[model samples]
Target: MKRQVIRSTTLVETLAGVDRQSRFQHRRAFTLMETLAALAILGMVVSSLSASLHLYWKYRSVSRSQITIAQLQRGIIEDLTSDLRMTLQDPVAVRAASMVAAARSESATEKAGSEQFLNVTEQVLELPTDLRNQPVHFIGTSQAMALLHEQRNPRFDQARSSYQSAGLSHIVWWVNSEGSIRLPLFHSGPQLITVAVNASKDRRGLVRKARKDSGGSASSTSDEDEWLVAADVTSLRLRYFDGENWRTEWNSFQQQALPLAVEVCVTIEGGPEQETPVVIWLPQASD
Candidate 1:
């Protein structure tokens, strides 16, 4: 009986040892392929995380740019509204004289037998041009516009001219081909104030030029006079309302008048071609 119990105990101990050895061998048998697969999975997870983070920052930057552009658009609308409200009538002897000059330049010099014939022909060719009575003129095209109206200088404390008391300043909003919008204000003292809105030259983003103050130049020769009001503009379009409908083009010289309402549309980079336009209603001549 003692021999039988000792044999059973030794057998049980041998089986347990064998089981431990088998478990160790199984652990050692793990293939390099499995390890590589695990590493690949980890690498993929890390790459995905990095890409997500990159996209998040990129989107955040784009959002900030859009917000800035919206703010700029709002400010422009406000400024334009104020100017249109104070729009002045045509100043005398300006538009009509310009038309006459243009006509005279375009008119062909007729061959005549005598000086008397030439004089008569000149008088007949001279159409009675009405003197311009208002200080406002609007010339618009599909891609650009020139808006000339009157507005009080918001920078009264920094007025260039001391004699400027009333809001009788001639404001000109000119849009160029390179998506630069220039606002030039001329006062009674013939003082000129110019600023550039959304100026982007050669896709360099916002190019800020030093503000120029060269007295009364309608168009500043110096680039330093350009004040950057906004950036990344794509296009600027203006339309005029003639009581009944809207016209894409407005020539004050041809119409010999100002429109009842004006619509201004501005396009920024990465934005739609047509934006919600700022509509300005003008008071009649009687008003």
Candidate 2:
């Protein structure tokens, strides 16, 4: 009877210890459903954060592009305004000067003698008496414009070191797809301003060419003179306001006067508003 009691007590103690251990393990470990729910919540939080970051970066890029384009547009408008404001509007005098310059350029190219110089003077005197000149210094089209404007001599321009005096300069503004264009004034002759848009797959941009008079001859435009005003320009349109209405074309020689205003629209790639139009009033036109 003593041995039976001792064996029963030992078996009861062992069973109780096993039950306590099982309960402790159940309390320490998580359920499969709880673990899956926690994991799903974590995934959602991470996905939401990633999407927010992506949107932020996308908006940042677009904003930067738009700012750059706006700045470029402002610069273009300012330059056009300055040039048009200083345009030399004396049609007869401009026509005579242009002719003389043309004759001189041709003579220089041929290495002619004093006879060529005399011919330049004679040609200027022989201009037709008609009030409307045949070839005007100011010519404007939808895509391009050329005019005789007085450009201020830069006090310190490394590119235009030869420009000592500020005089009536033949200015041409146009869009060019070609990588680069070099126009030698001597070779171009009377057609000092040539608007050529070559089909190029490399790049497209707005170009400004200026041929300034040095002494009696028109100096050849250097690389600096042929400036790439704006890059990645898809389209450029120029409209002239003649006080009465807006026209796609204007010839000072035919109209015998400058346009009252000019509207320039430039379209560039990678901008919020791909196209921007700037209107510049010509002060000389009012006079």
Candidate 3:
């Protein structure tokens, strides 16, 4: 009887222990519905965080691009303003002086002899309107502008005796579609400088070309002659302002005066289309 009672007690204790372990496991483990709910909540949180991070990076990229463009625009404006302000020769005065010189030459030829006078007069009368008219140093159009300006920093090369003095330089700004181009500001000597757009499959930017003469017949492999000003330019437009009104084109030869101001509009590509217009006043014109 005692052995049977002991065996029964042992069996009951073992069963109780098993039941307690099962209850503990059931309490500790999640239900199927609870697991699904927790998984959904976790996914939502992860997605929210991912979206926030993506937005942050996107905004940062756009902001950086905008800042870069803004700095470029500021630089362009400063350069334009400085160049325009330092114009050396007044177109009106230059044209007047040219006219006076021509008149004196004709008078002197007339005094030389009647036969020579007749021949010269006939030649002058038969000359084309373009040739007869005085050429103005300043020429501006909707897309391009050329002017004579004083060099800010003149450099004389001791090694190159042939280099001209940089007291006066000719500057031309235009827009064109070609290859990747960038031109640095060159003040080596009296040079005919041209600024234009260079466009390629990968990049588009402004290019500067400096030549020894206005004819651009001389070519050099020097990197200083050609370089880039800025990149990723979409468009460039130039406008002129007379004393009375704004004009899309200007010719000092025809108008006999310089524009009061010049407006430059540059459009950049990236993020959103950004266009900045900069106006530079001409002190020579005002004078």
| C-alpha lDDT score of every prediction, in listed order | 0.56, 0.66, 0.57
lDDT score for candidate 1 against the true structure:
0.56
lDDT tens digits by residue: candidate 3, 152-211: 323212224444435444455544455433332222122323343233343336543232
Pairs that collide, model 2: none
- Whichever of 1 and 3 has more TM-score, that candidate is 3
TM-score of 1: 0.54
Ranking by TM-score: 2, 3, 1
Q: Which candidate number maximizes TM-score?
A: 2
Clashes of 1: 10
Q: Number of clashing residue pairs in every model?
A: 10, 0, 4
Ranking by lDDT: 2, 3, 1
Residue range 131-213, candidate 1, lDDT tens digits: 22222255455554444533344522332343333433334444434556544333232232444444335443322222332
Predictions: Cα RMSD each: 10.9, 12.2, 10.2
Off by over 4 Å in 3: 1-32, 91-135, 152-167, 179-204, 211-224, 285-287
Worst 10 residues of 1 by lDDT: 205-214
| Candidate 2, backbone clash total | 0
